[model samples]
Target: MKHILRTSMLVILIIILAACANDEATSNEEGNKDEGADEELKIFTTVYPLQYFTKQIAGDQASVESILPPGSDPHTYEPTTKEMVEIAEADAFIYNGAGLEPYAKQISDSIKSEDIKILEAAKGIDLEAHVHNHEEEGNEEGAHEGHNHGDQDPHVWLDPISSVQLAEHIKETLVELNPEQEEAFTKNFEELKGELEILDQEFHSQLEDLPQNKFIVSHAAYGYWEQAYGIEQIAVSGLSPTNEPSQKELENIIEKAEKHNLNHVFFEQNVTPKVAEVVRKEIGAETLRLHNVAVLTEEDIKNEETYLSLMKHNLEQLTKALSNSKSGDSSESEEQSDSDHGHSHGGDEEAQKIYDGYFEDSQVKDRPLSDWEGDWQSVYPYHEDGTLDEVYTHNAEDSEDMTAEEYKEYYEKGYKTDVDRIVIDGATVTFYKDGEEKFGEYTSDGYEILAYEVGNRGVRYIFKLKEEKEGLPQYIQFSDHSIDPTDADHYHLYWGDDREALLDEVTHWPTYYPSDRSGDEIVHAMMQH
Candidate 1:
C-alpha cells in the first residue's frame, strides 16, 4: 500500500510539470492579450528602410514591419495578404506620406483595423514634384496639364533636412509606444541627425566645385536634394521612377546633354534602368548610381552598407561624372549639336528616324480575342525577336501584331536584366512565375494579351489587372496596375481592334512625349552660364 501511494504521488507530480510547461507556452501567445499585459509598440511603415530604422531603435522589444515588399516599387506597391494582416494588427504604421507612396490611400481604404496608428513620415515638409518652373508658362502655353498629383515631390528622404523630420516623427511614435526607450531613441535620432547634417555638408561642398548648375536625375524624387543643394535635377518622371519619359522630352534631353556638355547621366538600382539606358545611349554619356534611400536590395543590404555609405558613394559618383564633363572629351557631340541643333542634328535626326521606323513597324491589335489566334515580331525594343512579345507565341491579331517577347524585353531592359518567365498563345502570352502560375495580362486599346500566363512575371509594368472592369477595352491598360510610359513615347499604341492612348488621360502629355528635362532652360544654363 505504501509503495503504490508513492508511485501515484510521482505520477501526479509528472502530470503537474507537463501541464505547467504547456501553460507557459500558451501564455507566451495569449500573454499580450491579458488585461494587464504591457502594450507592445507597433511600428508600421510602407518601405523597408523605415523598418530598418525602427529595428535599430526597438531592438527585440518592438514590433515593426514596413508593408512594402523587398525589390518592389514603393511608388505603387499595394498591400499583400501578409501585409494586410500586419496593418490590421499593428499599433502604429508609419509611411513616407505626402502623396509619395501612391498606395497609401488604397491601404487606408481596405484595412478596417480600429485604433491602428497611421503616421506619415513626410509630415511636416511642403513639397513640389521634380519639375522646372513650368509655373512660368501658363496652361494655355502647353504646360503639362494632367492629373491630380500637382507639385508634390515625395522624396523626403533624399534631403537630410527632410530625413530629420522623418526620423523625428519615427522617434515620437516610438515614445508613445515604449516611453522607457524615449531617451535612447531621442539620442539615437540626434546622432543619426548629425550624420545626415554632415552628408548634407559633404554634398554641398563636394558639388560646390562644379562649373555646371543643372544635371539630370533618374527620377523626380531627387527634387529635395536639388532644392537643398542649389543645383537643378531634371528627372524622367515626377514622384515615381516607373513613369517613362516622352520621346520629345528624350530628344530634348539628348539635345541638352550635348548642349550643356553634361558628363554623367544617372540611374537607380531599385528602379528600372531603361530610362537611364535611353539617356545614356541618346547622349552616349556614362551612367552612375544615385541611392534613393527607399529600400536597399538584398545585395546592398548584405554588403553592410548603410544609407550614409550609399549617399557617400552617390556623392563620389556625382563628383567623378561631373568632373569628367568639364574635361572636353566629347567635342564631337557638342559640335554636332551646334550644327544640327534646333533643326535636328545628326543624332537627333537618327533618333527621330528610329522612333518613326519603330512606331511604323510596330504592331496594333484591332479586335478582341473572344476566341484566340498569330505571331508578331519587333527589333528595337527587344531586338530580332529580342523582346518576349516578338519571340513569344501569339494566338490573335490586333491593331498591331503584338510582341510579347518585345514587351518583356522592354521592361527587362529597364530593370537592367531579362524577363524571368514566359508563356504565350496565338492570341495571348502568359508569364508563369518561377514559383507559381498566376501571371497578369495587358490587352488595351486594340492590342490584347489575356489569361494566357497567370503568375508573377517579374515584369514591373503589367503586373496587375485591377480585377478587370466591364466593357472598357476588355483590356484597357489602366485597368492593369502597370506604370509604363505610353503617350510620352512619341507614338501611338497598337491594340487589336483599335489603338489606344498611353497615360495621356492622367498625364495629359502628347502622343510619345519626352519624359526627361532634356530641353529645359537649366541645361542651357549649365552650358552657357
Candidate 2:
C-alpha cells in the first residue's frame, strides 16, 4: 500500500509539471503575436501630398509623417538632425523630387541602408518647364531669382490626374513594404482613384465653359492647371513665392490684370507677399486665398483639409473670379484698348501655346508617314563605344542628384536596340540588322495616347504594314513627345507583329537620331536634352 501511494504522488507531480510547461508555451505564443501586431511600418514623407496619399493607402498597416512642418516653405526648409535620424530609421522615405525639396536628394543619398526605400513621387513624370517672365525685356537680370527650381516645375500634385499618379506610386511603395495587406491597399487605392477621377471631371465640367479663363495669382505655381485646364494664370511672382517680380515686371503684371478686368488677386495660404498686396491694391481687386498644398497651415489641419478639399475650394474661388463681371466701370475707349491688345498678356506666347493645347482630344492631329521620313541611326552603338559617356556625364551634372554611373545605367536600359539602322522614305521603312535588311510598305494607322505607370503620358504615331513580309515587322510606332502632327527630329521607335502589344511596350524604346549628324553633334543634342 505504501509503494502504491508513492507512485500515485509521482504521477501527480509529472502532470503538474506538464501543465506548467504548456501554459508557458501558450503565453510566449501570445506575446509574440502582440509584438508582431505592434510592429507597424513607419513611413516619412517630405511634403503634404505624399503624407496624405501614404496615410490613405496604408490604413492601419503603417504610420505616416512629414518632415516638413506646417506652413513652412519647402523651398528654404531643411530637416533637423532628429528628423534626419528618424527618416533614416524609417521603413521608407518619399519626396516630391523635381527640385521641390532641395535637401531631399542629399538625405536620400546619405541613407545607405537596404532596409529602407527612397521614392520620388514625381519620378518618371514629365514635368512642365517653368516659364519665367523676369527674363523679358526691361527686367533686371537678377530679378526674381531668389528661389531657383531649375527649369522643371515641381508642383504636380495640383492636377487631379497627376495626383492619381502620385497616389499610385505611394500605394505601390506601401504594397512593397507590407505585402500582407495588399488587398486593403489595393481597395483603398481604387477608391481614392475614383474620387480623383470624379474631381477631374468636376474641374472639366465646371471650368470648361467659363466666360473668362484667366486669373491672377501670387506666383507661377499653377503651370499644371494652365496645361490641364484651358485656364491662364497671370502670376505676380516667379515659380517660388520668394521670387518676387521686379518693378518693371510688377508694372507689367498690374497692366495685364487691369487689361483682363480681373477682380480678384490670388495669394497663397502660406505666403502672402507684399508685392501681391501691392498688385491687389493697384488693380483694386479683392484678395482671394489659393493653397499651394505643399504645406498646410495649422488651421488647415484643424479643419481637416485634404488635397481634394483644397482643390475643390480652388475650383470654387476660380469660378467666382472667372465668372464675375468687370469689377469697375471703364470707358468705351479702354475696352477698345483691351480688345486691341488681343490677349497678349505681356507677350507670353508660350503660355498661349499651353492654353491652345489644353484639351487632349483637340490637341493631337493625324499625320502621314512622311513626318518620319529620314535616314536614322541607333544611339545604342554610340552608348556602347563610350561615345555617349560625356553626354551621360552632362546629364548627371544637370540632374542635380544622380551620379554618372547611375544615369548611364538608367539610359542603358532605355537605349538598348537590336537594330542598327532605319531608313524611312515615303511610305517604305527599311530596317537593317545583323548584316541584313527588312523592308515593309507601311500606312498611317492613327495615333494612340498611352498613360504610363509612372504617371506621365505619351503619344505613339503608329503605322501598319500593307502586306505581311517574312522578315519585316507588321507594325511600327514612333514617339517623339509631340502630340500634334510634326516632323520628327529624332524619335523612339517600337515595332512588333502585334499592334496592341506594341502600344503597351513602355520599356526598350530604342532611340534613333539623324544618320547625317556626326557623333559629336549627336552627343551635343543629347546633352541639350
Candidate 3:
C-alpha cells in the first residue's frame, strides 16, 4: 500500500511540471512575436516602383508591400475593404500622387489614425499636361470616359530623373517615420540616386544619335521620356491605355507613322493590345513590348525583373526599332548614289526637318552670344585625371561593336583641349590658356548650317571678334546641339583665324561645362553624350 501511494504522487507531480514547461514556452514565443512587430515597420505602397524603392531604401528596417496585386492596373484598381483596413493599420502609406491612384486620396483622407504616415512621391514635381487624342475634336464624352485626371499627367516615375525625385520623397518620409534608421536610409538613398543617374546617362547616350526619333505607342506613358531624352512618342491612345482613338485620330496616327517611317508599334504588358493590333494590322508594322514599370506581370516577377532590368530591356527594344532598316533592299549603285546625295545635301527635306527638331524646335530664333555667357571649364582635365573612365566603360558596355579600349581612345581625342577655361560675360569673351588670359569683344555673326557625312546637320552660331586682341582667334563658333537661341548648358567650341577652316575641323571638338561642377558632376554630364 505504501509503494502504490508513492508512485501515484510521483506521476501527479510529473504532470504538473510538464504543463508548466509548455506554458512557459508559449509565453516566450508570444513575447518574441510582439518584440519583432515593434522592431520592424510595416509600410504599404500603391505601385510597384514605390514598393521597390521603399524596400531598397528601408532595407531590413521595414517590411514594404504594395496594395496592388501583380499585373493589376493602378489606373483602374480599387482596393477592397480588407486591403483598406490593412493599409490603415500599416505604419506608413506611400503613393504616387498627382492623381495616379484615384482612390489614394480617398483612402488617405478616411484614415483617422495618427500612427500612419502618408507620403506622395511626386509631391513637388511639376507634372506634364495630359493631352488626349479626342480633346482636340471636342469629344467630351470620350475624353471624360477615358481619362479622369483633369490636365495633370500622373506617370512621373517613367523618367529616371523624375524617379530620383520620387525615391527622395520616399526616403524623406521613411526617415521621418523612423529617425533611428536615418543613416542606413541616407546611404541607401545615395546609392539609389547614383544608379538612377547612371540609368539616365545610358538613355541619353544610346538614344541621342539614333536615326529615327519618333515611335508609336499604344499608350502615352512615355511622354516623360520625350521631355527628358528628346525622343517623340506618337501615342495612339491618350494618357490612359483605355482611351481609344476616334476613326479620324486613327487615320492621323497612321499618316504620321507613314510620314516618320515607323515600323514598330509598342504595346504595354498589362493592357490588352486589341486597338494596337488594329493599328498594327492597318499599317503592317511589327509589334514591340514596352513595360511601363507601373506593375509587374507574373512572368516578370518570376524572372525577378527590377526597374533597372526592365528599363534596359526597353532600351534594347527601342534601339532595335529606331535603327531598323528601311522596308526593302537597294542595288549597289542605288545605295552609292543615295549615300553621295546624303553627304552632299544633308539627305532629303524630311530628314533635315527631323534633324532640326531632334533636340529642340526648329522654329527657335537665332540666339545671341549672350546665350553662351557663363564661366566654363574644359572637360579635358577631367578625362586626363581619369574621372571620365567610368563613362567610357559604360559607353563600351552599351556598344554592340566597340571595345572598351577603342571607346576610351575615341573619347581621348574628342576631349583634347589646350584652352583650360573660358569666361563669357555679355559681349566680352576671355580665353584662359596656360595661366594667361586673352580677352576679346565678340559680336554675333549669322548662324551657318553644316551637313555631316552621317546625313545629319548642325548649326554653328558664329561670333566674330569685333577688335583684334593678342592671342585671340578671329572667329569663334559654338555648337551645343541647338538650332535656335537658348542658354547653352554646355558647348563644343572651335576657334581660328580662318572661319571656313574651323567649320571643316570636326574631329577634335573640345567640350566644356560650367566651372562650378565637380569632377563627378562633369563626368555625369559627359555621360549624357
Evaluated with TM-score, which candidate comes out highest? 3
A best-first ranking of the candidates according to their lDDT comes to 2, 3, 1
- RMSD in Å for all candidates: 21.5, 27.4, 19.8
TM match of model 2 to true structure: 0.55
Tens digit of per-residue lDDT, candidate 3, span 1-529? 4433443454444345545554676778766876665588999999898998999999999999898889998887867655665666678989998877877776676563566899888889888776554222443544543256677878887788988999999999988888988999999999999998999999999898898998889877887888888888887777777777777777888887877778778888777557778878777676567889999887577556788878877886677678663462111011110111121113355534533433333554577775676689998898888888887687677666678777668768877988999987546688899998888778888787777776555677898999887899999998765566444667788899999998887777777877877888766544543
Compare candidates 2 and 3 on lDDT and give the better one: 2
Candidate 3 minimal-lDDT segment of 10 residues: 331-340
lDDT of 2 by residue, 161-256 (tens): 998999999899988888888899999999999998999999888898887888889878899888888898888777777766678888888888
How close is every model to the real structure, measured as TM-score? 0.53, 0.55, 0.56
In candidate 2, how many Å is residue 17 off?
47
Comparing candidate 1 with candidate 3, which one achieves the higher TM-score? 3
